[model samples]
Target: MSATAISTDVYTQVQQFYARQMHALDACRFDEYAATFTEDGEFSHTPGRPAAHTRDGIARELRAFHEERFATEPVQRRHWFNMIHLIEAPDGSLRSTFYVLVVTSRPGERQPEIAPSCVVHDVLIRADGGLLNRSRRVEHDYLLDLKRT
Candidate 1:
């Protein structure tokens, strides 16, 4: 009803969107993962990796990489998002930034290892009755640290 309440509700919806998206990715559900993005969504990483454009591009690229990783060694990747901050633009789109910790494990590892963490900035919008990511850029912590030294 109030402005703050509406903002909180929007943030909550985006949070829920992230929950579903991450779970789908963790489980290697390619279709589900792709659905989290817009049809023309683009995902890119800062420092090195090339961007993947479009929903199919995002899904295919990740699927190939993950499938190969599974084939070489059954590695399970779990993504944890934290410290999410959201800002709504006047045009009704949302900009969000969050920290991600990727935990990975394989057959004989004593414990899961924490892979290099990153800060992800995403442009999200409400579409097709739900929130979808329009663009995402990941800034790797190690890469940034390396630049300092």
Candidate 2:
């Protein structure tokens, strides 16, 4: 195959990996979400929010927060990714930016509340089997509406 084709394939793989990651999160599959990262991967909502600098760190933080905050609540989250832009790095890795819209709803809610759509900047490292997310930075576009049910 040609070089361009190979690069396209790699990009597509990375995109699909990201899609699956979002799916896992939407499904509340936290373990799977944790598995999407590398051992020392980093996932951060923003600069001020707590950052998960490793797979174990992410799992710990997420599990603890979920247990404490939503122990008795039932909610669903859905993420939509769009405007994906990818570029091949010098070492054949991939760098990508995309826009994401997340909506959260409770079981009896009349309407799902949409979180501020954000731009995600990410670095994907190509590994032996596939691509792994080395880092992810999320930039929220608006202030969070914190009025709780």
Candidate 3:
């Protein structure tokens, strides 16, 4: 498909898909978040870790990561996302570059502070007349050294 095929309606649907993705993640809805991806989706976030492939694999990886984070940090974490650019790939997929800001706040903290500003690259495909992510990768602006105690 040509770029011209990416009409306003398709664009709007893509945006909505992203919105739902962020909402699901923020709410810790792993199942819903996994649903945003295709059955054979892939996810890569942390360095040196193997990428999660398939919807079930994605859910398992996220659940383990979030559980570990919540258990150790004792802080509330929130994720905010904004689409910076959306391009139609030659294969008809939508390639998006987005900003992800993760905020962390202690129970009695004055304000929530940024944990990391991450750039996310996602390949979205049209499935069942809706957009679903085929692959997603994230790189953080800051070092994620959790052993800094």
RMSD of each: 3.6, 6.4, 5.4
User: What's the count of clashing pairs in each model shown?
Assistant: 0, 0, 0
| TM-score, predicted candidate 2 vs. hidden true structure | 0.81
Candidate 3's error at 122, in angstroms? 0.6
Better of 2 and 3 by lDDT: 3
Candidate 3 residue-wise lDDT, 89-141, digit = tens: 78788988888898888888888998688889999988887889999999887
Consecutive 10-residue window with the lowest summed lDDT within model 1: 1-10
Weakest 10 consecutive residues of candidate 3 by summed lDDT? 1-10
Q: What is the lDDT of residue 81 in candidate 3?
A: 77
Evaluated against the true structure, the overall lDDT of model 3 is 0.83
lDDT (tens digit, per residue) of candidate 2 on 31-130: 7888888889988874455888788887777777667756798878788889888877667667788999888889988899887689898888877687
Candidate ordering by TM-score (highest first): 1, 3, 2
lDDT of each: 0.84, 0.78, 0.83
